[model samples]
Target: MAAGPGRYSKRVRRQQDILQILAQEPTMRVKALAARLEVTTETIRRDLEELAEQGLISRTYGGAMLRAEAEPALSQRERELVKEREAIARSAFRQCAHGKTFMIGSGATTAILAKRLAFELRNVTVIAHSFAVAMALAQNPTIRIIMAPGIYHAGEGAMHGAQTIRFLQDYAADWAILGASALSPDGPSDALFEAADVYGTMLRQASHNMIVADHSKFDRMATARYAQWSEIETLVSDRRPEGPLMRALERREVQFILAEG
Candidate 1:
């Protein structure tokens, strides 16, 4: 028996309705979906197959599930290093003066300092390449936030490009708080070439360069060097080195501020 045009149209509508429902609550079984849509189990299977092919869901043995979201969360790293980050942030804030313009680079520690500065400091201008830092300071009316425009890097939550460098050239800050992937007696290190260029520009535009890092970052080296030891005025770290490395920094006149744990 041939199905009427109206009946065929209604079936197509039912399939779309089922797909929408599954999209909202994606772990529904075929039998459950059939019952909800008042359709047979075979019809539910066909709908699931169609949706799965469109990259919306995955077909399990008895059910369908939504595709997982792709962004990584900071919860794991934050939980493990909360104490270290807090100590670094507190020490970094001390270097900042009221009514001074500052530039903060991207990193977990610097991001925390941005939030702290927004609340603790008054009438300050903050220039940052970090989206996270900008968002943190956006709520404070007293602190003016200027974001450097460029290509956004999701991992660092910062923008980087030739435009970013050009924008930074126009203004000089009283101080710049920066983060490094690694730090040795030789200098601050970074893994990306573009990041190195941006950091270099920030250092050139600032009067004083302060580095914020945790204990683990010391004595480590990455692919590129951003700043030499003499360029850094103060080192704000959670841990202070002893022995020969400490002596090396002292000979270079690099002031180290060990944050209280």
Candidate 2:
């Protein structure tokens, strides 16, 4: 059967979905993809083979992975993960309902949450470091937007560096709504050093921290560690994580929420 607005077959639609998943996380196990897509392992294997032949993915022992540099650029990443991020953001946004002020960071996921606040949230103040986020909240009449001082990194669509940390240090917020460049069992992280520093400050400056990441973030990797699993009060994602990662989050007492599409 065809899916979405386009007349796409089962195979083509599945392949398209696979690319979006790969855009978020470079690697994907065949079994996991099969479960998520509601297909058999053999079917996923066949799809992987086709994608590999087309130079879209490289096959692994039981799965496939995108080349490190093959990950989508900032704009592309946002476009591909639209549905997942929307779901994740909706859940994360609800958590900040009781708070009067927030410390929101950058990224596609954060941007979605920003839009919700601009349209729906009332009488709130936001301390933000991302230009994209600021623009979104500007549409609302009540929410106050504070831009953190720093060098704006256009590539990340956010601000970072020593100045940002210094600026964030001067204030405390009720909640910090943030995103990860990549997430692993180690916790949430970003590949950029400056971003890591800014997020680290955001984590401490807020009394509560809620992480919004799509499930694909689990298979992604990044160098700069921003917070430990225990440090996160809640994690909202498009899908539930696998067993070990789920267990780890539970052990750390992080409230994990799977946002439905």
Candidate 3:
């Protein structure tokens, strides 16, 4: 998992903490991290070095900065944060109403939820543009899978274009379960510009909206700001968000559900 619970190794937790800190601030020095984390400067330095090597951060002299990684392909993302995403997917399954239609978005977490829904929910209808989501939902003979038509995106394994948006206009769903590239105080954003439009349309086409993301996305920025906090009804994640992001969600009255690992 990318950032699991406290059960993870101390080194992994500390490294994740460093990334979390960097997410709130632009950059942090090794000395500052050592002081904040109550560890030796050498330990902080080593952590920063490892994070840089992993391409998750950039070493800047004695400090480190968050690296703006391009959106990874769906397959690559599916291989990361497996446990965390699964936990979130299971928690999100409770929100699925039996015999209801849902507008699902494309992402590793949403795809996982699709699989769970296939096993748990009966007589449900799912409208999605993602190949992974459709294939997963197809496992249940009782659940109806509606695929949106559009130009297929190889990187995302989803369909996105004007055609997709136009197709969604013809139908509405009881819930819109979407995934996000990043979640900041501003709102949830998407790394891929092409997919963001489709997600926004899904939100508009559904009566309620829920965003499924893990803690790794907190305080991070992305290429497209898809929806405002007021537009979202719920956020399902593996960990509780802290600081400004939490305050923003509270102020906006967005429900926050921490998925137990």
Task: State the weakest 10-residue window (summed lDDT) of model 1.
Answer: 68-77
lDDT of 2 by residue, 118-231 (tens): 878888999999888898899997988999888978777778888889999999999999888666556787767888888889899899999998866675446567988989
Instruction: Please report, in order, the local distance difference test score of every candidate based on alpha carbons.
Output: 0.77, 0.81, 0.88
Model 2, TM vs. native: 0.73
- Candidate 1 regions exceeding 4 Å error are 1-79
lDDT of 1 at 152: 82
Ranking by TM-score: 3, 2, 1
What would the C-alpha RMSD of candidate 1 be, to one decimal place?
16.4
Worst 10 residues of 3 by lDDT: 1-10
Q: Predictions ranked by lDDT, top down?
A: 3, 2, 1
Q: How far does residue 171 in candidate 3 sit from its true spot (Å)? A: 0.6
- Model 3 / residue 194 / CA error / Å: 1.3
lDDT of 1: 0.77
lDDT of 3 by residue, 1-261 (tens): 575655358889899999989977745778989999999999899898898888787666678767656778999999999999999999888876553999999999999999999988888889999999999999999998899999999999999999999999999999999999988777888988878899999999998889999988886667788998989999999999886679889999999999987
TM-score winner between candidates 1 and 3: 3
Better of 1 and 3 by lDDT: 3
Off by over 4 Å in 2: 1-72
lDDT of 1 by residue, 55-147 (tens): 655565587654432223333334556789989899878877553899888877788888898778878899999887888888788888888
